[model samples]
Target: MQQTEFAFVLPQGYVDPEGNIHREGVMRLATAYDEITPMRDPRVQRNPGYLVIILLSRVITQLGSLEQVNTKMIEGLFSGDLLYLQDFYQRINQNGHSRLRVACPHCEGEFEVETVPVGE
Candidate 1:
């Protein structure tokens, strides 16, 4: 098997969304809070904007086009609906390739990541 270097690490303005990656202190605090309370809490690490968000963002950096990125991020995270995911996957294949499939180590959730070629 041939090894290929990663094409994209992060996209411009990606850090703009969350400002920066969550700090170690923030992660520790969130974990502690989740353990202590275990109630519906925003501080929990599994919150919408937590680790999974970061993981997905990194995945988007690897896409070959914007459609895959948009569909994977917008449709998957916000909608969590299968129809949208399938459509996105089909569209990516239609473009002559498929996106990288990233599965969460903690959860069974498998998602796609794409790296879009930047515009001129």
Candidate 2:
């Protein structure tokens, strides 16, 4: 079986009320149930945008020194971090891999490179 979980470093990071900065985290590949269950959530039904929050809360197993990952914590994330997580989720689960084809600008050499969720 392939790896089901992926590690990520947030670009902006999440700052808690105590001023703790959380950058490193782990996210597991979402299952069919993981995607479906969130749709039934009242919050998602009320606001479709909230689906990402619920979906992420279910897959994010860890975030820095946080004891538990929850929707509240996810909601506190910076926009960049949230975007990173969204892309990361798709890359790992939808693509079934975290790699993409790229070409070197200078030499035009094509190669496969592991993708980082955060943008440069």
Candidate 3:
């Protein structure tokens, strides 16, 4: 079976009003509709950067113990977490995996490292 969901741990995480920090979450592979619908969002139209806000919310199916992930919740995330999610989204969607190819500058050797560890 194909894997459609990816698990992640935010660097700084999201803090709720009650003062709880959520670092672990799950983001699923984005579909064509997920990418297209957000482009039509008024917020995205107003600020091009907001496209990522909506896009991440749709793809992040779960965030810590949250029942549902939404745009407002996404907006509450720390800058580091947001940036991490953006890179994660690009990695999974574009590369079809969370591993990154790296080269050792000293030895000129190459290896792949998992950005988001699978199966926890």
Candidate 4:
């Protein structure tokens, strides 16, 4: 079966009001609706950057211990974690894989490496 969901870990993680940290989460492939609908949101219309926040909120099915993931939760993520999730979303949705292409400067060789959380 084709994989529709992917697992990811944040670089810094989101800290909740209770001082709890959430790092691991799951992101699902974005459907046409997931991509298109966000553009119509007033927040996105006001600030294009908000599109990612809305888009991410819809596709992220789970985050650490959170029972439900929402736009507020997404907005609470640290900048580093948000960046990590953005890249992760693109890789899984656009590339159909969770990896990044890298080049070795010494030998000028190209390599594909899995993208994982730091210190993992």
Candidate 5:
């Protein structure tokens, strides 16, 4: 079977305690268990916002030079990066691609753009 992993660059990379910036990472398509299991976590019950953290931690296979991807690391990501990852996760798992529809203002032409979340 083909790999379902997708690569992404964070809008604002995660800065570790050692000051290392982690920008690029890989996230796999979320399995049924990946989505359902987190609902049982007490943290998700306490803070609904934390659902994204747990979801991303489970899907992200690698993050730059990090030895492991875990909830603590996901928690450390900048808000922008977190939002980017959430969108990315939905695009890959739900839509199966990062392409988004776009329209040209001048000619009114419609097209699709493959979005990559990255810093300006």
Candidate 6:
């Protein structure tokens, strides 16, 4: 059997203003105990699971602790009516690399995209 992996997507902000991630969830957000904000962009959700893991790992590296990483992620996800992230990546069609797209969750503006591979 092919090894199936879980892919996670990062949004620039919350898509719905009234959307409750704890109940009718699009992304698995953090618990209510954290303080970080949620990103609402839909495109970030298009990224692969490994990319998500890698992204968070880099965050963990910066934080200098694994526990803090999860705490920060969840905090960002649970806080605010909506949140936003500037940088994000997605898997490119017919390719192993990711296509970088920049957009605001609130404005839905499109910007330049960059292609980068995972596990680099």
lDDT of each: 0.34, 0.90, 0.88, 0.88, 0.89, 0.31
* Model 5, span 32-60: residue lDDT tens: 99999999999999998888899999999
Q: Considering only N, C-alpha and C atoms within 3 Å, which residue pairs clash in candidate 1?
A: 62-114, 62-115, 63-114, 63-115, 63-116, 64-115
Instruction: Report the lDDT tens digits of candidate 6 across residue range 49-112.
Output: 3334434333322221122334234335523312211122123212222344689789999876
Off by more than 4 A, model 5: 1-3, 103-110
In model 4, what is the error at residue 30, expressed in angstroms?
0.5
Candidate 6: residue 88 Cα off by (Å): 3.2
Candidate 5 achieves a global lDDT of 0.89
Worst 10 residues of 2 by lDDT: 111-120
The model with the greatest TM-score is: 2
Query: How well is each residue in 1-120 modelled by candidate 4, as lDDT tens digits?
Result: 888989888888888889888888889999999999988889999999999999999999988898888899899998988888898888899888787899999999999998776536
TM-score of 3: 0.88
Error of 2 at 72 (Å): 0.4
**TM-scores, each model vs. reference:** 0.21, 0.89, 0.88, 0.86, 0.87, 0.19
Task: For model 1, give the 10-residue run with minimal summed lDDT.
Answer: 21-30
User: Which parts of model 1 are misplaced by more than 4 Å?
Assistant: 2-49, 62-77, 81-120
State the number of backbone clashes in model 5.
Answer: 0
Q: Candidate 6 regions off by >4 Å?
A: 1-68, 77-95, 100-120
Worst 10 residues of 6 by lDDT: 81-90
In the predicted model 4, the residue pairs found to clash are: none
lDDT of 1 by residue, 9-119 (tens): 222222214444211110011123323443343533556444333333333333332323432343333232223333433344344343567799999799887734222
